[model samples]
Target: MLAFKVTTVGASSGFILTKEAMAKLNVKKGDTVFLTDAPGGGFRLTPYNPDFERQMALAEDVMRADRDILRALAK
Candidate 1:
């Protein structure tokens, strides 16, 4: 597991991403990260939100369910 320090950002708060962590995430300065509540109680950081992923998965399921209809129309 990795740990990060919460630092003060003038009036707000933020964390520092080390070079190693940045490398692991394949991102650089000006990039964005998503933070949300973890399962237990803490927080989590993500490149993509789980909610968005869930919606995308639902869309994929709908498309897959109509695959035969799509193929017939594509012909």
Candidate 2:
């Protein structure tokens, strides 16, 4: 596991990502990252939006349920 240290950001505390961590996460300065709840315990840091994934899953379900209507509209 990678380790990070908490530092002061003005009056707030934050962690600085190392170059290796940044590259591994495929993120650059000003890019947004999410800290989400993980299974069992702790948190997960990811570049992907979990809400978007859920929305896409719902969209896919609707598309599958309306496949015939979609196919007709595509023509």
Candidate 3:
């Protein structure tokens, strides 16, 4: 497990990720990472957005269902 030190960031608390952690997460400086609740009372950290994935899935469904109409509209 990787450990991080909590530090104060101008009145807010933040943690510094080590180089190894950043590499494992495949993230770089200025990149956005999300911390989400996991099963069994743990947390998950990932660079992907779950909500955006869901939204994109829904959009794909709509696009597939309306392919004929969409094709006509493109003309």
Q: Report, for every candidate in turn, its global Cα lDDT versus the true structure.
A: 0.87, 0.96, 0.95
lDDT string for model 1 (19-63, tens) is: 989888777899878888999999877777688899999999988
Ten-residue segment with the worst summed lDDT in candidate 2? 1-10
Candidate 1 segments whose C-alpha is farther than 4 A from its true place = 73-75
- For model 2, how does the per-residue alpha-carbon lDDT over 28-74 read when each residue is reduced to its tens digit? 99999999999999899999999999999999999999999999999
- Residue 47, model 1: lDDT of 77
Candidate 3 residue lDDT tens string, 1-75 = 998888999999999988999999999999999998999999999998889989999999999999999999999
Return the clash pairs for model 1, or none: none
Q: What's the CA error at residue 75 for candidate 1, in Å?
A: 5.1
Model 1 lDDT vs. the true structure? 0.87
The predicted structure with the larger TM-score, 1 or 2, is 2
Q: Clashing pairs in model 2?
A: none
RMSD of 3: 1.4
